[model samples]
Target: MDDRNIQYIIQEKFHTLSKSQQKVATFTLKNLQFVGVHSATNVGEKAGVSETTVIRFCYAIGLSGYAQLQREVTMFLFNEGNNSSLQNYLQSKQKLIENPRFYEKTMEKDASRILNISKNLHEEDFNRASLLLHTKKKIFIIGYGSSNLAAQWLYFTLNLLRPKVVLMKLETNEMIRSLQEIDEESVVIILSFHRYFKEPIQLASEIQDKKCEIIGITDSRIAPITKYSTITFVNEQQEMSTIDGMPALISFLNTLIVGMTAQDHDYYEKQRVKYDDFQNSFIADRWS
Candidate 1:
């Protein structure tokens, strides 16, 4: 089997795919392990498409056949953790640094990914998401695994700007208790990326059940959470590595924060002043 990132291939070819093929693509991206193991007929049933359509989707993405598609999916899943070790990470960084133009290449990649955000994310959705964050009585953020850091950054920054911003803990019982407090006036921001977790998807679904607005920050348009999102920002990564996407995701969040602050400059300014005062008086520890 050729070495290609199945998820990237599917995403790149997604727009050109027929609607039925797109369904298969979405399902395949979301459920790679299932696709790797299941028959075309089973995948078809799960994706709500015909078995023939699933086979065609494989060809549409440049795979030779269903067998090659399965191999690609399996290999991608197996290699997901290949660079996860500290030693491997250090070696990768070392190799990059050995290149004379490493800095330029790295910056170029980051710039490209950040620029792609404007293409994948729509202005109307961005404006609506910003407005929702500013107006909602309560805001909750949920993310897991690799997404946790981004979630925490957003929660901390948002709390500085507004009141009642909750960073939902990962514990199921605690999450359920927190969910009880959400209502139509609440807005939930769910951050999920490739190798997506189930908890955030389920939480988004429940938030949808409560008729609350959801701001989904994800890498794919058909990510399960997007189905429940009131507004979604798809920050598709140019590479398979989650680390490569961090700069773009952070940039997107920074823009959202700027938008929220811009909505009421005076109010946010006052809030920041109060925040500084509170931090200086209560939170800071100084050694003189």
Candidate 2:
């Protein structure tokens, strides 16, 4: 397998790539296994671009042509922490069907990979992010499409540790009202991943104009949200099932929540005690 970092190329040069080229790049990156064995025309059709655009995208990233791109992708599949090609990997997994522990093994591998990736995260970045969340006057969390779940998780967890946290509504008018409340003292945490949505990007741009700090929780450096973020936590996601797998992202959020709590245990304890008091009061029918 070759050592080419195709992801870095697409991310670093994304701004320069034309709209069609960008589309092709996104499709290629997501379906590298297909690209390794398919023709430029097939890829172009799948990406809704022409074969010429696909070839241009390959050259735009410094590859000689489609053939070289395939070769590189094939190499990437083989070298992706496993010494097997894409085809071989699929074959091996298929052969495991009759095995008693196949499903368990699959689950274990996925979980292991998700956790292992977190190890690459820098402590300094976490510290900076924790401090920002801890000190920011207000924190607004937003996500769209499939990412909304992640945004909600962060909002709920962070609110438990502090106050003035809100999960922004997805409706345009409602979100705009929340946006109007933002200022330099606000910190916006945006969750975005592949098949990137447009509203979040627009929201980030608006947040940028407000001069507030943006914390981007996304899947890659290439994610559009990162452009406006003051700090970014990139947790690579996988299509482990019919839907996207977000164990890694959830884990990262847990880390941030714990880090923020550790930053000031007294505040967290007070908040917890207050929550308990409210629960007790409700139980006693003390409120009208």
Candidate 3:
């Protein structure tokens, strides 16, 4: 879980916390993990505040000491915090009335998350996945919850660019039933983010016995299920105080769709022409 209490601090103490205090708060909210590792002096130095102000900031937040605050920061940064679902970041707020420092810090956090994930998207994995997507007989997807929706979206859209695909829903027994039938030619793509459903990894682990490929779309390298993934693309999983959702992972899926589509020019052109012809013939009749 991610922290839900920070926004309350931004709301209640925005006017009261001095400029230096506000910097401390914004910096902490954005990079809690970094602060957790830094000493009080280092933290204060980074945020352009005094060590006393850092300790005072911790005390202001109901924490006993800077060390206690650091522990909570660790929990939140490492996704071990006993906090509520991260829907606080999904709220809607007008930019005109928003906390500028908080919003800026939120953007910075997203950038850090995205860059960190980019750093982990090993090039060899990308090349291997591109080849797998191009050569695989079929693409089978697995995901539950939000990841399920993303899987469904990928299944529907990728068909326009590739060949056969399947999203054997999150049913474990059914997955096992289907897994037993899939040949070595088939590929599995697992879509999951925070609190990843365990069943996918279990299914993939089983499929590994048959020498099948596994791909993962997840939140971060720190994610629990990542080591099982042959190829994992980590993307920012929305960290704003008022944003609907993260679309970064979808952008990568869309990229793969385009890459596979570009592989064979004639096939792509013929499919586009056929689809356009069908659309022109059928869509206009319904509209008129």
Candidate 4:
């Protein structure tokens, strides 16, 4: 509603709409370009609902009417450009499902998403985020649901590059206690995507109140976490689902890790060597 982000608006109001309207919403979200170009009657036919239901669906999602819906969809599609259109991405994904080269096609899709990060992510923000990771006194990484995997990976990798890197747990009491240790010098990296869990946003808000720097990695620029963040990296997922965003998120984290290490190559290289030595020594001590 705030940004004319039709997808976000539909998602927010999806559960409140009627079954027929929900169908139209789902169809419109998946086939944005088609909805933009076609009439309400044609869209309803494709969604397997009546034209009236389609118009109602538009209003249900807070649009003025069918015309406004079309305009919103058109603006969304135009802003996304031809390359990143949801319709084209969905069409390609459907084709891949029927193709014999399943593994290759899957990797190709992920590769495309990773490439998109370079285009979408701001260079200045990336550099500043890397610098924060390199110099911050303490670092905390948090992500809920599927995003936790990326958070854990970053915590593990970053822990080797620097000390005092904590992987924040999702438990309420634990998170509250962890807050006591966080200060302005601490940096919190949060990974949140579609179907975003509220815990991270809440935690980011708390961190913001403490004057700590928040680095937000999310699918949308308007994601709630962004409001509380000092730097944000938007990794828009091709699909509507949550898990599909992992590859790009991990790739972005990897690039961030590389950038952070590049800041003081000699120091981080020494840290990695020390970590490897400790691991080998621990293994020998346990085995012996």
Total backbone collisions for each predicted model: 0, 0, 0, 0
TM-scores for the candidates = 0.82, 0.69, 0.62, 0.70
Q: Please state the error at residue 216 of candidate 3 in Å.
A: 1.4
Best by lDDT: 1
Local lDDT at 139 for model 2: 89
The full ranking of all candidates by lDDT, starting with the best, is 1, 4, 2, 3
lDDT of 3 by residue, 14-89 (tens): 4467777778887775567778799999989999989999998877766688888777666555553533355444
- Candidate 1's clash total is 0
Poorest lDDT segment (10 consecutive residues) of candidate 4: 82-91
lDDT of each: 0.84, 0.78, 0.68, 0.82
Query: What ranking of all candidate models by TM-score puts the best one first?
Result: 1, 4, 2, 3
TM-score of 2: 0.69
Runs of candidate 3 with Cα error greater than 4 angstroms are 1-70, 73-83, 91-120, 172-174, 236-245, 284-288
Residues 165-268 of candidate 4: C-alpha lDDT, one tens digit per residue: 99999777888778988998999999887657888888887788888889989876556777888998877754654555678888989999998998999998
Model 1 alpha-carbon drift over 4 Å, by segment: 1-4, 30-56, 62-71, 81-95, 277-288
Report the lDDT tens digits of candidate 1 across residue range 42-129. 9999999999999999889898999999988888788775656344335546767888989986788688988878676777888888
- The parts of candidate 4 lying over 4 Å away from their true place are 1-94
Error of 3 at 72 (Å): 3.4
Tell me, what's the RMSD of every candidate?
A: 3.4, 8.2, 10.8, 10.5
**Predicted candidate 2 versus true structure: per-residue lDDT over 1-288, tens digit per residue:** 233256656665676899999999888877888898989999999999999999999899888999988877776566564642344446546756778988997777567757766776778988988888888899899888768777888888887778899899877788978999999888888888765888889989988989888889876765788788888877653331213246567777888888888889898899999999988989889655
